[model samples]
Target: MKVKVVSLLLFMTGVMTFAQEDLKEREQQAAFDPAYTSYSRKKPAYVTLKDGTKIEGHIKDVDRKKGQIHRLKIIEDGKKKVEIQATDIADLYMAPSGLEQLDKQANFFNDATKWGKTDATKHLSKGYTMYTNQMVSLKNKKKPTEYLMQVVNPKYSQVIQVYSDPFAKQTASIGVGSLKLAGGIAKSYYVKKGEEIVWLTKSNLDEHFDRLFMDSEDFKSKYEGEKFKWSLLGVYILDYTEFALDAQMGEAK
Candidate 1:
């Protein structure tokens, strides 16, 4: 009789353990599960938190209780001198994007091109391609568009590669130099743990880029296409250790 009771208790314990694990799995799925596969259109939505912080990137998840942004993405501004990214600015109004969003943008541009409505917006090419000399010059001159390349996936973009990641272990980092709207050079450093830094190397991920924009907003009249200027633009000539983020990386050289 005692043996039967012991066996039943063990079985019940196993069932409870499985049930708890299932619940955790569900929670993670609802929260951090992969939402993007190749050709998977991710949506764009501005998540306004209680603190009035607005960002222009895609929302990964929202932590309303903790007042935080999860998995937010922003374009890297090529000009700024600080670690904070200017594209990280959250707008009071949020824009939406999904896999279908790409098709929509394409369709809209296609219709415009089909109709020759050049005044509407400049037509955009689909996916990454070698930039034309004119396009390259314009982007290099403008700066913002040049840095937009980092928005997708730096590793996949293959423009800038991570040669090292010493924080996690020995590390290597790939850096490609880009210009700010005002002609300041910025190098983007990719860390192995899927983190990207545009100007300065370290990031907490939750910090917004509004200040960077505000600091760099002086060249409105000077730069023609997309106007971006930096306020405090002191250069940082430090080794990779300055970016001290808490993620595993390959090696630094």
Candidate 2:
């Protein structure tokens, strides 16, 4: 009886150890798999079509081979899955979650005018009007000014340094110049204000804001003291727009 009890305990221990090892192996494999990594970062988002149809789902994957998100896999209604090309989506909104709570909700629009153009412009609007990880606002309903903030600098770059040795021997070293690409390096603000496209920088921010909130003393008093940082420009714009919209809604009420 004692031997049988010990044998049973040993069998259970072996099974537990095997299960833990299997789990650890799976975790290590997942870490090395790009698909697995992308899947783990999937987030809830909503895609809107040009015809005013909205589809809510989890963005499973973003195909970004050409420096932009060209395709997206969305799991709709919690189970119904669909893959959408960028051309089909008018806009995409990604919800904030967990550590992303500090980040602004991502909103991208499709700029139709740039479609089928060549050079960097072709990459600009493959089918979608806007780039990922950006904020968009329609300031005027009657005139409809689309306010957009984008990063102009490369997200990543590599620096290579070569040295010549004069003391010992002469040698030649060949290095490959590989391009590193990333998004949201340098910030640029653009506004399509009533038939004109205006680029806003540090110099013009004050002028634009002044014109935008000409009658609102409250907006000026609250934001005038705040220093503008490039990294936080999007957040500031989003907050200011929300505040102005809220104030307008309140006045209407």
Q: List the residue pairs that clash in candidate 2.
A: 109-130, 110-128, 110-129, 111-129, 155-182
Best by lDDT: 2
Per-residue accuracy of model 2 over 89-206 as CA lDDT, tens digit each: 6656543233111111112112222112332233222211222222222221234322112222111000110111111111132211121112212223344333343444444666
* TM-score for candidate 2, residues paired by index: 0.33
Alpha-carbon shift of residue 49 in model 2 (angstroms): 1.2
Where does candidate 2 stray beyond 4 Å? 1-43, 64-70, 78-81, 100-187, 203-253
